[model samples]
Target: MLTIWGRRTSSNVQALMWCVGELALEFQRHDVGHRFGGLNTDGFRKLNPNGTIPVIQDGERPPLWETGPILRYLASAYGEDDFWPRDPTRQAEVDKWAEWAKINVAMAFTVPVFWRVVRTPEAEHDHHAIEKALTALESTLAIADAQLSEHAFLCGSCLTLADIQLGHVLYRYYDIDISRTSLPNLRRYYDTLTERPAYQTHVMISYDELRRN
Candidate 1:
């Protein structure tokens, strides 16, 4: 069985867990990082030098770190040709969406929201930073909403790795309170994502608990 090292609440870790459920692969998970705090130990660093959560070790292959790469590896390895598109052009489209999620979406939206709402102390919170982050996220989400209106998934009709990666971030957005943003298409897409059994089990959690930690 594969071994996943990270706390359950980490968005990156949640993405891997969701992928595992989607593929129906059996694995063991260990709580590490954040409040758990085993990441800096020499044994843990041997697997992930960066001391980040969501690291994974397969039976033979070297351990993997970072969220997006881990998702691609699992989808390609265990998902066969199902979750990933076979055609080169379509595969490129999938890659494009995944890349967008990492660079534009995760950096601008997920990280800031996580820091402000979960990590930072309420008294020390920077409202201006949160506001700026939210504005940037809303802009990006509007673009996604428009795209979702045209296509069933990020790349096209089929659910691919793109959806898994972006969907995890969408989970975070749903928790945060946003003002006056009209994103019907995005909302519909998010609802569809939540309907999946894997999402309900692994991604959806009470915002109060997330904030409390």
Candidate 2:
């Protein structure tokens, strides 16, 4: 059994939860960020000095924080060779795509794009800035679109840790109101992800609570 501490709506938490779900691991979660507002609490701060969400602890092991390490820990411990290859070379291959997705896609989309459109008031939106951000974002998505064109998943034909990192954001990417450039392969890949029970349960959650209405 695993213990998780993060709100379901958190993208980082969604990624971890999806991993847990995929591995059929038993776990429990608590809401503790954004509107939940428990970050600065002494207990949470002790669990994670950074006071970040998506922290986890497995049985007697020390608690883990930071989304990347926590996900990697789960993959290392629970993931099979297909999901997170045990071979160093194969592992690097998956890690490459995972890092690329986090740095290129997640970083570009979250603060610059999603927050701009979803968290900011409509009246205060900067359309020009938004367009510029979208332009930059699509350039990265095109890379994934191309990779996905050749293979069914980010790392290969089967889902891997890379997919967890990359695909977690697609739900909001598609649901939000924006003028998106069509990349058929990317759309197909995302559509395939939508069919998964774990993805549907964790990654496809509604973020209405985070909206600035």
TM-score of each: 0.92, 0.98
lDDT string for model 1 (1-213, tens) is 799999888888888999999999889999997778899999999998899989998887899999888988888788856478677887778888888877788777766866786667778777888888888888987888889999888877777888887888887787665553779988889899988999998999654545643
Residue by residue across 1-213, what tens digits does model 2's lDDT show? 898999998889999999999988999788899888999999999999999998898998999998989989999999999999999999999999999999999999999999999999999899999999999999999999999989999988999999999999999999999999999999999999999999999999889988986
- Per-candidate Cα lDDT values, in order, are 0.83, 0.93
Which regions of candidate 1 deviate over 4 angstroms? 80-82, 207-213
lDDT of 1: 0.83
| Candidate 1 displacement at residue 90 in angstroms | 1.2
Task: Rate residue 90 of model 1 by lDDT.
Answer: 72
In the predicted model 2, the residue pairs found to clash are none
- Clash number for model 2? 0
